[model samples]
Target: MSLLTTLNDDIKTAMKAKDKETLSVLRMLKTAIQNEQIKAGRDLNGEEELTVLSREMKQRRDSLAEFEKAGRDDLADKAKIEITIVEKYMPEQLSEEEIRQIVQAAIDQTGASSAKEFGKVMGAVMPKVKGKAVGNQVNAIVKELLQEN
Candidate 1:
């Protein structure tokens, strides 16, 4: 099912179950999706939907980090919950091993032999791993592999 349709259904389920936290997150996600559609002047495709979801996930993760750094466990816990909720809609994440393999392949394909060619490897790898791996993780792996070359 489309992400919007699934979100709608889950919203209803959350309401029926009186799940306040889940209901709130679902409504927020639905609004985000609608806003993106309006901004684009068309409904989002699957990839676009994934992009929105990933953005939401990233925001929560960043917030979680900030909250933890400031010793605000309460807010950090909330951000963790939000992250978990958003993760339900994301594509299955790639493992580190898988990301390493993909990054290696991209480096080889792009003939990026050194850190100076970081952008070339990233450009090639990002498209293939879009929505499946975190950019930072992939970047670190690329750098580690490149430095070893």
Candidate 2:
């Protein structure tokens, strides 16, 4: 099933199971995804859905960090729970080793020899890594590889 369909089914399951926390998070996810679709002026493709899911997860992580910084462990814990719920829908995150392999391939493909061509190498790599690899992780790997080259 498509991610959207799975989400809808999961929402119903959460509701029926009386999983209040899961239901609330799922509802929020549904709302965010619908908002993204409206913004795009059409239904999102699978790739776009993954993009939205990634963005939501990133936002939760940032919020968790801010909450912890302010000494609000209660709020941070809630955000962490919400992040776990959100992550259920995300594709498997790439490991550092896997990400490095992809970056190396991109460098070879683009013939990128310096940090100055980071964007060029990134453009070549992103299509293959999107949704699987987080942006910061990919960028760090690319930078490290380029610096070593």
- Give TM-scores for every candidate, taking all chains together and pairing residue i with residue i: 0.98, 0.91
What tens-digit string does per-residue lDDT give for candidate 2 at 1-149? 66778889999999999999999988988888899989999998999998888888889988998999999999999999999999889888889999999999999998999999999999998888887877878999999999999
> How much does candidate 1 score in TM-score?
0.98
CA-lDDT, candidates in order: 0.93, 0.90
Worst 10 residues of 1 by lDDT: 127-136
Query: Model 2: runs farther than 4 Å from truth?
Result: none
Question: Where does candidate 2 have its weakest 10-residue lDDT segment?
Answer: 127-136
Candidate No. with top TM-score: 1
Please give the RMSD to the true structure for each candidate, in Å: 0.7, 1.5
| Residue 99 displacement (Å), model 2 | 0.3
